[model samples]
Target: MTVALMWEARAVAGRGEELLAWARDQGLSVRPLRRETFRAPGDRVLVITWWDAAYDAELPELPEPEGELVTRPVHRWRFESVEQGA
Candidate 1:
């Protein structure tokens, strides 16, 4: 089964671009199969990385951005792929 890691954060008032740039420059210890980034209406940025490891396996994670750039701590989630016709 495939697994994916989702990391999301809301930037401070007008720091959306700055936060997104920071996330873009960050690197992971374990390389992912693919990665995607998105921006939302409320200065929010979302990053999803596809991984080869299982959901329970140890994986690298993105660190939180500077305090001044974000309104709160980052939110993270892990999901495992489910068979469509099972």
Candidate 2:
């Protein structure tokens, strides 16, 4: 099964773009099979990375952005793929 890491954060007031840009430049120690970033309505950013490992496997993750750029701490989640379609 393939595992995926989902990270999310909200910018402080009007720092959404800056936060997104910062995230874009960050790199993970383990390259992902696929990665994507998204913007939500309320200055929220979501990043998803697909990796070729089990959900419990150890993996490198993007570091937290500088505290000043975010309203709160980043949230992270992991999941194992049970179905996929192309």
Candidate 3:
């Protein structure tokens, strides 16, 4: 069996790029980790990423007037697609 992992995080006063960079750095050291996007605005969005270990993530730096991290519950959908990929 295979498992897909994704992380949804919300941070105030930060561009998605900053968060993406942080995630990307971690991905450099781990496999199957990537920055997947859901919904994004100026300072709020959903980040879908993979996990190779239990998440006890330390928050990264945000933009000006930074806000604390609000770690959302990570959710994933499990399914097998056709060879062509549905």
Q: How many residue pairs clash in each candidate?
A: 0, 0, 0
Best by TM-score: 2
Candidate 1 off by > 4 Å: 84-86
Q: Give the per-residue lDDT digits (tens) of candidate 2, residues 1-86.
A: 78989999999878899888988888888789999999997789999999998779998888888758988899999999999899
- lDDT tens digits by residue: candidate 1, 1-86: 67889999999988899999999999998789999999998899999998888779888888988668999999999999876473
Stretches of candidate 3 exceeding 4 Å from the true structure: 28-30, 33-39, 42-85
Question: How much is 49 displaced in model 2, in angstroms?
Answer: 0.2
TM-score of each: 0.92, 0.93, 0.41
Worst 10 residues of 3 by lDDT: 57-66
Candidate 3, residues 1-86, lDDT tens digits: the string is 22334444555455566654544444333444334655466544444544334344432222222244334433333322223434
Ranked candidates (lDDT, high to low): 1, 2, 3
The models' CA-based lDDT, in order, is 0.90, 0.89, 0.42
Query: Which model, 2 or 3, shows the larger TM-score?
Result: 2
